[model samples]
Target: MSEAPFNLVYLGIGTVAWGVAGLKIRAWRRDPSPGLLVVALTIAAPATAFLVAAPVLYRLIDRVAHRGNLATLLVYLGITGFSAAAVVLARMWTPPKERGDAQVWDGATADTWHEVRRRLAVFAVLVPVMTVLFFTGGATAPETPLTFDTTFATVPQIALFLVLYQALFGFALVDISRVCFGHASRLPTGPLRSGIRLIVLGGLIACGYVLCKLIAIGAAFAEVTGTEWLSTALGPGFAALGAVLITAGFAGPAASAWARRRRDYQALRPLWDLVYRADRRLALEAPPSAWTERLAFRDLEWRTARRGLEIRDGQLTLRPWADPEVVTAAALVARRAGLDDEDRAALIVAAALRGAAAALNEGTAPRPREDQVPLPGLDAGPADERAHLVRVARYLYAPLTGEALTAAATTTG
Candidate 1:
């Protein structure tokens, strides 16, 4: 197989790792959660491994260090670090609700710390042993970085080194695969569950990659010729494909979540404007301009949440001026017009809010407590409320809503 394809794969994986790592770093700066830090390491470690393993960087590192095959040591270290990080992440995993339970949280935290210590201890012992074994095993080999495993397998020291490294790597892959598969199976159908499933699948493929390398190494040590192709082509091929899937798996839920927040933030704009215009004091801070808001990408979840809160505050501030008669009238008009439940609710809320905004603007006397229009999602949870508010915002300028408002006014007149 051409080294070109493998080089491209390594490069692509490294690029994705850096991109995702940047996002993870930014998020950690904002939240600084332990899990987030581990997640970032999980990506950065493999990325560094692949980058150093790439033909160009492999040669550069070896040349710079004045040691042949030093890149191989670094690559193994990177892989081992990734395995440790992944296992730690799986051990620390907990549902959102369980994360809030003090007992469960404490237990998980303690267990995670213990696991971290255990893995660090293993690294301290195994890393130096692997390094000493690699250097003492052999001097310089003419084979390229891509074929180092097959070429060095005949040397007892190097073979032992490969065996030790693959043992830890394989065990971590199997452990994480099992945990991720179980968690994914129990998770409700969603982006998160799908992401976990992909990770599980990637881990299984990586296990295959490890198995292939070991098989080729054993064959080479047994004086078998031509098995180098397994290590050179088949093994690395599995690693490359597995890396792609794992990267995509991590990116999927995060990208989808960010997109959803962006959509919600944009969707709430008209409703935010309506409320802001009625009472600027309701805004927690000066609002961003339209273009700036549209272009803003960082902290989207926080921004969307804050924007929703501000809109709700504005609604509360204008509640005294809201007229229940308008909502009732609009609902009747919408029903007679045969709109669906969702559209009818949206149109009714839109008409009520419009009347409230106008009344607040005109300095009209506050309505009696009994006549005040209650918000549609007063009792809803945050997510349901946001969805309901987005619906109303969509219809805020709809022709049907405008017609309903006018008809309600005529009927109440």
Candidate 2:
């Protein structure tokens, strides 16, 4: 009884399988959507159960009880749970009125009477079929748990078990296909959309298992019988690969959103830096270095909001020196360059900011004109302000804008 080296393959699968369970747990805690709950349970429960029971299923069967337990727990429960999850997803996204008469899904989704009865029929068939194999005596199946051709090759029981198992899988996958397609077709471009696509890809990959199984079943039926490897080897391999892909897909949306925000935060860096350099007093805290900025992934929206605030503050402090002439000159150059209205406004603001900063730096800024009425400072809500600041930032680093600012500084001087 040499201990089989720890199955690294199952170890990897177990990691994803448990992580998915955690997601389901979190979704339940957040919204308590029963449809989502059912989806979580159906996927997470069977996967966890299968992994836990693998050790028992992998060994040679020497008992009268559960001669078909592998078929029951692994094959049957796998179909049952996943099918229920598909139904749940379909109901969640698709409108009730749109769900046709072909399948009736109750508000609870997976528990619809139609689905229940159908699953019960399969269960009813399995109970008798599994019981009929006692006369064959105890069997020694080869390595790689479940679907061993040699274990019950000559027995009618194996054929019935395989048939029921495949039928159940086919039924479940049909609903799963509906959910995946519905999600892919309808969800707008976002993390959720991408996540659904990953699930769809994973489902397709997992379908390979069925294809391999069908090939093996066909070979058995034809009595040519040399392709057991298709079901025993290729089927589970595809299933494992699909599991990994599905897990990744489930996480895709959240991950994508996180990445998107991080990108937006990073994108605003150039402008944020300019505001800090122009008026250090406006900044609530010292700016982080470029390397630190790159690494700062958390609270990005808050940081960006603060950056906008400081940019507005910097403009306020520079207002007494706010030359309408700089705006006028900047506008002329921008218009000649064929800048759009938004770009025109942004470039004018950029030129004004650079001139003010340069004047304070040069220490030769002219005395404020007492008679000229001061233009209003940047007065807007944070969101609108942020948008304008981002625009200004865009032109801040441009060579053309730098030249314009230098020219504007000379004019002001």
Cα-based TM-score, every candidate: 0.89, 0.63
Superposed model 2: Cα runs more than 4 Å off: 1-10, 13-79, 94-168, 182-195, 214-224, 276-286, 289-291, 297-323, 329-349, 356-391
Instruction: Compose the digit string of candidate 1's lDDT tens values, residues 319-370.
Output: 8887777787778878888988777877887888888899888889997788
After superposition on all CA atoms, what RMSD does each candidate show versus the true structure? 3.2, 7.4
lDDT of 1 at 335: 87
Q: Which candidate has the highest lDDT of all?
A: 1
**Tens digits of per-residue lDDT for model 2, 196-286:** 7777788778778778887787677667667887876688688778777777776676566567557656666776666677677777788
lDDT of each: 0.82, 0.62
TM-score of 1: 0.89
> What's the true lDDT of residue 55 in model 2?
44
Worst 10 residues of 1 by lDDT: 99-108
Q: What TM-score should be assigned to candidate 2?
A: 0.63
